[model samples]
Structures are given as C-alpha cells and as structure tokens.
Target: MELYQLRTFVAVARAGHLTRAAEGLHVSQPAVSAHIKALEDELGVALFTRSARGMGLTPQGQALLARAQSVLEQAEELTRAARSLRQQLDGELKIALNTDAEFLRVRELLSVLRAEHPALGVHLPQNMSHFIAEEVRAGSLDGGFVYGEAPPQGLEAVPLCSFRLVVIGPLAWRERLAGATWADLAREPWVWYSDALPCHASVQRWIAPYECRLSKVAVTDYEGTIRALVQSGAGLGIMREDEGARCEGAGEAFVWRGDSLPMNAYFLYRRDRESDPAMRAVLAALRAVWGLEQPLASAHMRA
Candidate 1:
C-alpha cells in the first residue's frame, strides 16, 4: 500500500524476476519479497507465481500490472507537475530517440534549444521506440522523437517527417531483378531485425513466406549493422529511402521506393506538459528549423 511497495512491484513485473528487479531498485531480495507480499495481502490476490524458472504474472497479476503502471505513471507526473509549477524550464529537457533518423535530429534540436532557451537543459536518452513512448507517458522525458504506427496513449504525436520504405540490396542485385515486383524481394535471402525495433513487424510481412527459409546472414538491432551487411554483400534488407541515400551504394542500391511503405516520425510528449513555457520554446525552435512555425492545429491524441 506504500509508494515504495508499488514501485517495487512495478519493477519486479517489468523485470519478471525478483533478483534482477531488486538489483535495479537497489533493494535487497527479502525487501522486494516483503513489499510484494504486503501488496498481495492488501489486494487479496496473488500477483506473481513463484517458481524455479522465474516469476510469471498470473491472470490477476497481468490485470493489476496495467493499472499499476498507470498509477505509477500518474504519480510521477504529479511530482513533475508540482516541480514545473514551482520552477519553469530549469530542469533538463529529457528527450529520447530510436532510429538513426530520430538520432540525427537531436544535435540540431539541442543546439537550437540551447541558444534560444538558455535557462533550459537538455538530456538525450537513446533507446528503442517503445521505451521512448513509455518514458514520455511516464513523465521521465520532456519530449522525444519516436517511430511507430501510432502514438502511445495519452501523448501527442507531432508528425515531423514521413519517409518511404525500400528494400535495399547491393549493385549486383540490379542484374537479377531486371523486372521484379514487391513479391520478388521475398524470394531473396533476407537480413532482418530481431524484435522491439522500428518496422520489424512490417519487414516481416514484406518478406512474408520467404522469411521462414530465408538465410539470416545478419540478425541485427543496429541500423548501421544492417546497412553494413547489405553493403558487404550479406543480403537484401529493408531501409528508408533517405537512409539508403546516405549510406553506400547510393547510385546502384536497388531501392523499391514505389512500394509506398510509409512511416510517420513523431515528436512526442505528455499532454499536460504542453503548457510549460520552456517546452513551448523548445518546440518552437524545432518548428522554426522545420518551417512549421505557424500555429499547430489542436490535436488531442489517444495512442
């Protein structure tokens, strides 16, 4: 029933183990266990099933996990709101990035924000797209650029750029695909991403049946590695048209830009944090750089 209990519970649920969660929270194993036991006793339901392998959330636990996350998120937001009310733009502007495109925008945004809003500080937290979304919602990030099908719940997504996806291959691929269709990309050896990455699921669908038997010369989470593998004669891989242009083999990189595989890059933040003056200036700087300085239309997002 205490805040620490809930925090411990959330950490355990996220880590799916007591020892790891305890280490992350800087607490002892018994302390974590006691907190969970106390929480379960108060709630009158078991949250996790203890086992030799590891802890697994029960049906009740899964149900509580959602509400627990929301509660913890809101609690942190409350603290941030109070802090923002008392002090304006004094803290770091915590931002997150996922893809290379998102990462590329940071230096520019930081330089502009610093020159314009000298009172404000900036922090970059490089992580996957999903974590970027989650941290923004949890008030751990002031703003960030995330790539996904849609925005995370309770956060506004300001569309910055939209790029066309392409299936990229080396110069030699041009000879084999004299007249190739979207389906033809599936027939070749595929070098795909692992998981929890941008466009992984879409890449899977694009490669379809061939993904089962296709040789995965490089299973990488790094975009640079994928590009390197493709350039080093590994196999065909998925990339954005802009990304392909910046990498090697720009002239002979077999690109399928006609496939309308578009993804919207978004700058995300908590809905309540929009009124912060420093945050506004940071956003304005970005808009000025991107030629979107004109007032943005009112948008209330729900994932």
Candidate 2:
C-alpha cells in the first residue's frame, strides 16, 4: 500500500531473512515484519511463508515481485530525472573511513565534493571495516570505504586498490625479530587491533597456518593508536603498505617480511540506491579522484 512497505517487501524477498531486510533498510526486524503484514492485509494475500531456514515468498508473492520491482524502478527514475533537471544536491552522507584514509589520499575526493556540491553535508567517521560494512548495508551511512574482496549482501562494492599486510615492530626489535618465525612473533606481546576488524581476521588466518599461540597486550581499531604503540616498543602488529612508509624507511620500525597477507579495499554502497542523485554525485567524485577501473558487476566475497 505504501512505497516504504513495498521497498521492505522487496528487500525481504531478496535477503530471505527479516533481520537482513531490516538491516538493509536500517529498520528494526519487527518493523520489517509489520511492513509485510500490513501489505499482506491490505492486499488480502499472503506474501511470505516462514520456514526454518528463513522467510520465503509464497506463490502470490512471487507473482507480485516483478511488478513491485518495476514500480520501484519507475519511481526511482522519476526522482532521478527531476533531480537531473535541477542538479541541486542536498543531504547528509555519513561515510566510513578505514585505517589508511590518509594513505589512500581521500582529501582530493572530499575537496571535489565540497567544490561541486556546497549543500551536501559529508561526515567521515573512522571505524573497522566490518563495522563500516554493516552500517552501509543498514543505510545509517550513505556508503563507506571498506577493506575486503567484496561488500556484504544487498550492497555493491567497487574495488579501490590492492595492498599487502606486513608485520612491523619497533626498530629496537629488528635484531631480535630478524628471521623470526610466526611462532616467535606469537610469543611476544602484540599491539592488537579490534577483533572485529577485517584486517585482524585476515592476520589471524595468515598466522593460523603457522599454529602459533598469539597474545595481545593492547587492542585498538585506530591506526594512530597502533602506530604509537608499536613506535614506543609496545609490541609488533600488522600494517598495510603506506601505513608508515617513512617510519620503516628511517629504521624507526622493523618491517618483517616473513609473513604477509595480500588484501584489497573497496567502496561499498547499497545497490538499489545507486541512482540517487547524491549517491551518484559521491561516486563520481570518487571516480574522478581515484580513477579506478569501471565498476565491476560482481565483487569477490571475503570476510
């Protein structure tokens, strides 16, 4: 009956879970359920059937799905056409900044957006990749820079660049860490990152093959905190290329090459919202600055 309810129905059908649909819409699970229930009641038909695995569309629901999508697409096209006429961008976009925002040279993108869209309010918040991915999918934020092969389901991720994770420690440990095996590094106190971080997960997997018993002295998701800790001889940790190139080149920290993890970063945004004027503007700004390849239809999935 309502546009929001129709959108919720499509999201639920795509995700096959009430919780997942709620996340993509940035609403509570109960809210999603209510939307579906209201729609079904108004139309006098059952839309979805509950199962042990998840929600599934009934025969009538499947019959209605295509028409629903067409309606949504038509509405979106109307909005896009009208906005294209005025070209007045206005809205708040909250984006997630990963650990290496500086290294990624994101100032250029922000500068372009400021010069182009004076009415657009952009907020960049620092967070772990996993947390950022969830927020982007939940629509709390417009989009984000996330580290992983792909964005979460119901979102589209464009590959930004590739970087390798390398171990680094205080220069004082250079002599001690030379040729240090994974087992040796595991024994030492570590400047660990938030366990929820994608980098932390990757590092754990990379080291898992070594069968090392890892220990941590401090935990933080902020790169600055990790850098300071490692700089002050706290312990060793992983950093991507360009995390602290000057420090490593100056012998301030030991760059251990024994164990390394190859990784990629992506720009993640909700798929259905791509045609939004503000979102399109943001994507254009990123493309202008980063000059990445044409957006890929399928993103490789990774944690």
Candidate 3:
C-alpha cells in the first residue's frame, strides 16, 4: 500500500531473490519478506510463489507490476517537481563508476558539480559497466560511466572517450611472444575476464576470425586482478591501452603490438530523466570535464 512496500515488491520481482532484493533495497531479508506478506494480506492475493529456487511473480503479480512501477514513477516525478521549485539544487545523486576514479576524472567532475550546486551531494559506487547500465535504467542510480559499443535501451548516453584494448603478458613472455600472430597468441595460456564483462564479448568477437581456442588459466572480472595475474606470469590478459603501456613501461608486462580492440566509454542515464535539472547539471559537468561540445539531439547513439 505504501511506496516503500511497492518499491520492495518491484525490487524483489526484478531480482527474483529475497536476499538480493534486500541487498538492493539496503534492507534486511526479513523486512522484505514482511513487506511482501503485508502487501499480499492487504490485497487479499498472493503476489509471488515461493520455492527453493527463488520467488516467482504470480499471475496477478505480473499484471500489477506495471501499475506499481507507474505509481513509483509518478511519486518520483512529484518529488522532482517539488525539488525543482527550490532556489538551489539539493539532493544526493548516486553514480556508478566502472573503473578507477582517476581515469574517470571523478575528482574533477565532483569539484565542478560541487562548485555549481553546493547543496547537491554525489555518491560514487564502483561496479561493473553492465551492472551500472542496468541500475541506471532501473532508476537505482542517477547516472554512470559505461563502456560498450552502444548504451542499452531506455538509456541516453553521451560519448566521453574511447580506449583500445591490447593483449598483455608477463615480462618473461616477451621473448616467447616476439612477433606472435593471432594464432600464436591464442595458443598461449590466458587469464580471461568473466563472460559478463563487455570486454569479454569484444575479445570474443576480435578473436572469432582467428578460429582458435584459448587456454584459460584463470577467469576474473577485476582489471587489477588481471594485471596482477599477468604480472605474476599466470597468463596473458586483455587490458586497456594506457594501462598496458604503463605496465610495459614499468617492466611488469609485455604489450602485444597486434591489432587492438577499440571500445567507447559513455556517461549513461535514464532517457526519461534527461529533462530533470539535477541530471542536466551532472551532464553539463561531464561535458565540461570531457571537453565535449553541446550534445546533438541524437548524440546518445553514434552513427
């Protein structure tokens, strides 16, 4: 009946697990369960079917989910309208960062935002790029930096920059990998990224024409872990061009001179919130920091 209960219901429905929904809502599992139970009792119908696997929305729940979501959107719109009337922009904006703060220019971005809207607070949560996109689309995050060929549907993205991914190996492997071709590189032991990462797909596509299977020794999503493993001679890894150059310059890793995979980084937010003042403020700061011109009407996607 309350907005919190509806929010919990939507979160649980999307997550399909009590613990995950609780974590997303920043509440305890018991609290989430109680909210669902209370809502079901008040509505006189079962919202979800519980089992060992996870919660599944019942027929009625599925039908009402859209309505509940609409209600939440309306409530948020009302809040935004009220805040817009205030002389100063003041609220907490949660943004997700997919990489190190320095590379993202987060410090500079924050400084600009603070100077422009002193009352506005920002929260930077580090996460994977895809997860950041999902959270932004779901309205859990205000905006974030994501790396991909294009932003996901329902989101507007401003192109920030691009980086090429280069293959890197331990310093000891330099002699072994000297003048190595794609086929030769494929034969080497690899420290691969998780399939969930955007770079994983890029790597896969990049190597597809080579038609070779990699000997994966380890799999991880963290760039730091990949760098460390590669440095310790665990295997080869795909790293950003600048990072690979830094490691190579430090004599820690060897960067392959072969064709590199190119990727674009974007600042993404829910397309529906483009007109919101707070979102506009953040976007303006991002543009200034990235030295980008005024975004075109369709700049959200590259031609």
Candidate 4:
C-alpha cells in the first residue's frame, strides 16, 4: 500500500532473506517484517513463504515483483525530474572507494565537486572492488570505483583508465628472480591476495598456462599488507604497476621481469539512475578529475 512497504518487498524478494534485506534498507529486521506484514494484510495475500532456509516469494509475489519494481522506478524518475529543474544541485551521495584515495585522486574529485556543485555532499567509504559492485547494484551505494572487465548487469560504467599488476619480491630475492620462469617463481613463498579480490582472478589467469600452485605464506586483502610483507622478505607478492615501480625504485622491493596482468578501472552506478542530478554532478566531477571526455556513454557491456 505504501512506497516504503513496496521497497522492502522488492528488496526482500531480491535478497530472499530478512537480515540481508534489512541491512540493505538500513532498517531493523522487525521493521522490515512489519512492513511486509502490513503490505500483505492490505493486499489480502501472502507475499512470501517463511521457511528454515529463507524467505521465498509466493506465486502471487513473483507475479507482482516486476510491478513493484516499476513503481519504485517511476517514483525515482519523478524525483529526479524535480531535482533536474532546480538551479543548483543539492543532495548527499554515498560512494565507495575500492582502493587508496590518493591513487583514485579522490581529493581532486572532491575539490571539483565542491567548486562546481557546492550544495552537493559526498561520502566515500572504503570497500573492496567486488563488494563495491554488489553494493552499487543493491542501491545502498550511489556509485563507486571498481576494477573489472566491465560493469555488472543493471549498472553503467565509465572507463577511467587501464593499468597492470606486477609481481614483486624482497630486495634480497632480486638476483634469484632475475632470470626465473613462472615455475621457478612458484617455488618461492608468496604473499597472495585473497580470492575475494578481483586481482586474485588476474593472478590465477596469469599462472594458469604455467600450471603451478603458489605456496602462500600469507593471504590478505590489503595492498599495504602485501607491500609490507614483501618488504620484510616474507614472500613475493603482486601489486599495481605504479606501486611496484615505486618500491623497486626506492630499493624496498625487487620487481620481477615476467609478464604483468592487465586491469581496467571504472566508475559504476545503477543504469536507471543515470539522469539523477546528484549522480550527474558526481559523474561530471569524476570525468574532470580523470581527464575523461565529457558526456558519458551508455552502460558498458561485458565483452
């Protein structure tokens, strides 16, 4: 009957769990349950079947899911239209920062947004690349910087830049790795990234042809941890090209001459909210900071 109830319904249907839907909505579980109960009573039908596994959409709920989503989209479009007519942009955006702020030029982006759209506020929360994409798709985050081949479904991504991942080891191993092949390197202990990271896939692909398994001494999600471990002679690790160069130049780590993995960075947001004023302002500022040309294209598809 109410928009919030419909929103909760759609979120619950997508997540198929009360706790997750509540987290996505930023509300308590009880509140979410009450909303669903109220909606079901008003509609005179059960929307979901409660079971030990999780909430499952009933037959009627499955049929009405699309209509609920359409209603939400229409409401959002109306709000966006109203804001577009305003002389100045004014809203807060929750954006995810998947990597170091310095590397992403977040300060430069904030400066541009402050000057151009002073009324708009931005919040940047540090997150992992995979999690950022998921959060953006869930509508919990307005947008984020993600590293992947392309944006996931229902999202639009603007190509920021392309970079490579380089393998590095402690300075003590410089001579050892100088002429080492993939098999030789596999023998050495590695400070590897966890599988949850996108970089892990890159590393896996790079080593697939060689058919060797790395002996991981330490597995981490933080780039800083990997750098420190490699510097301490703990193990060889993979890092972004620029960071590896810096470490090698400073004599803190030795870069391996083997092939590097290619990666692309993108700024992603929900495709449906492309015309929102706050989203538009943020996108414009990001483009300026990254030196990308004006006028963002349609959602990037996976190739």
Candidate 5:
C-alpha cells in the first residue's frame, strides 16, 4: 500500500538480511519488520521466510520485486520531473571503482557527469570487483567499472575495452624471466594475488590447465601493492600491459613480453536500474569516457 513499505520490502529482499536492510534504510529493525508485515498483509501473501543466516524472499516476493522497483523508480522520476520543471535537477549517485580507481579513467567519468548534471553529487569508493557487482545489484551503488569475462546475476555489463595482461618482475630479474615457460614461472618464487580476489581465477585461466604450483613469495589483492612487490624483486606478478610498461620504462621492472594474456573491461549495473534517467546518463557518460557511444554495442551482456 504505502511506498515506504514497498521500499522496505525491496531492500529486505535485496539484502536477504533484515538488519542490513534496516541499516541501509536508516530505520529501526522493528520499523522494518512492521513495514514488511503491513505490505505482506495488504498483499495477502507472505513475502519473506526467516532462517538462521537471514531472511529470504518467497516466490511471491520475488515476483513483486521488479514491479516494486519500477514503481519506486517511476515515483522518484516524477518527483525529479516536478523539480526539473522548476529549473532544478538534483541527483546523487554512489559509484564503485573496482580494484584501483586509477586504472578506469575515473576523472573522465566524473568530468562527463559534471558537464551534463552539474547538480549531481557523486561518491567514489574503492571496492573489489565482485563486491562492486553485488552492491550495484542490491541498489547500494549506481554502477561500477570491472574487468572480467562476464558480469554476475541480475546485472547488465557493457564492454569498455580490451587489453593485454602481462607477466612482470623486477628489472633485475630480466635475465631470469627471459624465455620462461609456464612451468618455469610456476617454479619461481612469485608475488601472487590472494585467493579471494576476483582476478585470481582469471590469472589462473590466463595460463589455462598449466596446473603448476607457484612459489608464492608475497600475496595481496591490491594492484599497486603487487606491482611494488614485483618491482622490488619480491617475485613475479601479472598486471596490465600499460602498468607493466610504465614500470619497465622506470627501470624498476621488466614485462615478460612473450605471449601476453588478454583481459576485457566492463561497466556493470543492475538491469532494473536501466529505466532510471540518472543511471542512463551515467551509462552514457561511461561510454563517452571510453571515447564513443555504445562502444560495446555488439558486446555480449548477460540478461
């Protein structure tokens, strides 16, 4: 019945946890419960089921989520339109910068948004690729830039660019890494990514089925950290070609430059947010930052 109740329902469903949804909504848990109860009673169907870990949506709740999100978005748009009629266009969006903000042309993205929507407020937070995807899907973040083979569930991903990921090491090890094979690289002590990082699996796939156990000298998830360790002769590491080249030119490191691995970059957001004008504007700005409109027009996207 009430828009507030519907919002609470949507938040609960998205978070799959009552407390988290309550915190995100900036309301007390009891209030969140009351809202959910009222909505369920009004609709004559149970919307959630309780479990030890959290609350989960029932089939009925799942069915209503899309419709609820659409209603909320439309209502928000109506309010924005009314404000626009008065010559004011106010908006605030939270965006995640996956891995490192430096790698994604972040300044360009901001410039585009500022030019189009001067009143729009933007927040950038550093986050992992997988976490960024999850936050975007849960409506916590507007969108994020990530590198991967594909986007996760409930998201729409558009290709931004493709680049080579290269194996790199300290310049001092140039002789050691030369003509190194997968088996040789694996046998050498290396700077490796933590198992939890999204890039970890991709790095493994880069040398598919090699099944060689790397002698990990240092483990980390941060790209800058990995580069630093690799350049310090901590061991070998995999990184973007441009980054490796920069380090090589600095006389700090050497890129393998043998067979390079390819990685695709993409911008990800929830499909439900597609109808949002601000989100649409953000998407356009992102594409523009990549130097074209619909640059990934033919790129694959998950439904």
Candidate 6:
C-alpha cells in the first residue's frame, strides 16, 4: 500500500524475478517479498504466480499492476505539483528515446516546446526500443520515442515518422558491387547488428533467402557504432538515410537507397497517464515540428 511497496511491485513485475528485482532496488530478497506480500494482502488478490524459473503475473495481478503504477506515478506528480503550485506548466518531463538518431525529431519538438512552455523541464534518455517502452510503462519515463514493429503491451503508440532502411558502405567497396541484391550482398563480408534491434530483424528477413551466409565478420548492437565501423572499412551495414548523411562527409558513408525497408517511429505513452498536460504538449510539438504528412490514423496503417 505504501509508495515504496508499489515501486517494489513494479520492479518485480519488470524483472520477472524477485531476486533480480531486489538486486536492482539494492535491497534483500526478503524485503522485496515482504513488500509484495503486503501489497497483495491489502488488495486481497494474488499478484504473482511463482515457479522455478521466476515470477509471472496472474490475470488479476496484471489489472492491479496497471492501477498501482498509475497511482505511484500520480503520487510522484503530486509532490512535484506542490512545489510548482505557483505555476501550471512548471515541471520536469522525462522522455526516453530508442536511438541517438531520434534526436533529429526530438530537437525540433523540444525547440517549440521550450519556446511555448518555458516552465516545463525536459529530460531525454536514449535507449533501445524495448527498454524505452519498458520505462514508459513502468512510469519511470513520462513518455518516449520508439521505432519498431509495434508498441509494447500496455502502451499507446503515436506515429511520428515513417522511414526506410538503406545500405551504406565505403565508396570503394560499394563501387565493387554498386547494384547488389539481398542475394549478392549476402556473399560479401558484412557487419551484423544484434537480433534484438528492429533493423537487425529486418536485415535477417531481407537476407533470409540467402541464409545469412554473407561473412558476418563483425557484430554490433549499436547503430552509431555499426555505422562508424562500416565506414572504417568493416563492411557494408544498414542505416537510416538521415543518419548515414550526417556521417557521409567524415567517413566512407553513402546511402545506397536501393533497398526499401519499412521503419516507423512512434511516440509511446502510458495509457493511464496519457492525459497529462506535459505529454499533450510534447505530442503537439512532435506533430508540429515533423509537419506530420498525414493524420495519425493513416500514418498508423503505413507504420
């Protein structure tokens, strides 16, 4: 029932292991168990079902978890609200991003938000797609920018932009095989991204027919690092067009623009706290800055 207990519950839900969650909270496993027990007793429902592997949320646990998270979020907001009683919009906004490249749109959005809502403080953290979505759902992050196939469960998605992937490589290497299909590219040494990323999954599918035989000499999880490595003569790699352009002049970076891959960037917000003024302003700023080509409805279909 206490705020700290709710936090413990949320962490346990996310980690799916009481011991791991306890470690993350820097507390003993007993303490974590006590907190969950207290919470479940107060609610008169079983919050989790435990097995040898870890913990899993029961149907009732899922429902209460959502409500508990919202309650904890609002409790923190109340503390901030008391301090900002003199102003309506003065508060910190924590936003998480899936990648560093997302800064392109974030910068444009923040510029307008700062101009109009000067009292609002903004904090941005760039992370992988899944992590960003997890933070948003846990209420640690107010909202976030994630680019991928779909939103994580329990979060709402708003399309910001739709872009495709391109293969970039050193000019000399590209010149050797200027117009290569997925099959042809499969024959060369390539830099592979980790499977956790959306782009990596796309690449796997694109080259699935060839069975990933294209010498994966180097493997990286970071887009920026992979781009840099590919430019440093590692091998051909996939990247967004704008990201490739930013490093084109410095490194051996050039977009092939031949492969048409679907990539959709979305703004994710917790469903329970979607009506917060800060979140609304951020959404408006995003749409205005991006000059959203079409309505969110249409964008969703293509995304």
Q: Score every model by TM-score.
A: 0.62, 0.67, 0.69, 0.69, 0.67, 0.63
lDDT of 3 by residue, 1-303 (tens): 799999999999999999999999999999999999999999998999999999999999999999999999999999986785564689899999998888899999999988878899999898998888889878999989888876656678888888899999999989888899989988889999998887788789999999989999999989999999999999999988999999999999999988998998888887778889898899889888988888723245422
Which runs in model 4 stand beyond 4 Å of their true positions? 1-86
Candidate 5 lDDT score relative to the true structure: 0.82
**Cα-based lDDT for every prediction:** 0.75, 0.83, 0.89, 0.89, 0.82, 0.78
Model 1 residue pairs with clashes: none
| Model 2, residue pairs in steric clash | none
The alpha-carbon deviation from the true structure for residue 86 of candidate 3, after best TM-score superposition, in angstroms, is 5.7
As for lDDT, the candidate ahead, 2 or 5, is 2
lDDT of 1 by residue, 11-99 (tens): 99889899999999999999999999999999999999999877889999998888888898999999987775565456677777777
Indicate the residue-level lDDT of 236 in model 3. 96
- What is the per-residue lDDT of model 4 for residues 137-226, given as tens digits with 9 covering 90 to 100? 889999999887555556788888889999999999999789999999999999989898877787798899999988999999889999
Candidate 2 global Cα RMSD: 21.0
The C-alpha local distance difference test score for the whole of candidate 2 amounts to 0.83
Model 5 worst lDDT window (10 residues): 294-303
- Name the better of 2 and 5 by TM-score: 5
CA lDDT of 240 in candidate 5? 88
Pick out the ten consecutive residues of candidate 1 with the lowest summed lDDT: 251-260
Global lDDT for candidate 4? 0.89
Candidate 3, which segments miss by more than 4 Å at Cα? 1-86, 295-303
User: Per-residue lDDT tens digits of candidate 6, residues 1-303?
Assistant: 599999999999999999999999999999999999998899898999999989999999898889889998899899987766554577899988777744556777778988877788998777877778778778899988877755456677787677777778876675667777667777777787777675667667776765657788888777878877787887888887777777676656766646657788888887666567777777777778878643433222211
RMSD of 5: 22.2
Residue 20 shift from truth in candidate 4, angstroms? 73
How far is each candidate from the true structure, as Cα RMSD in Å?
23.1, 21.0, 22.8, 22.3, 22.2, 23.2
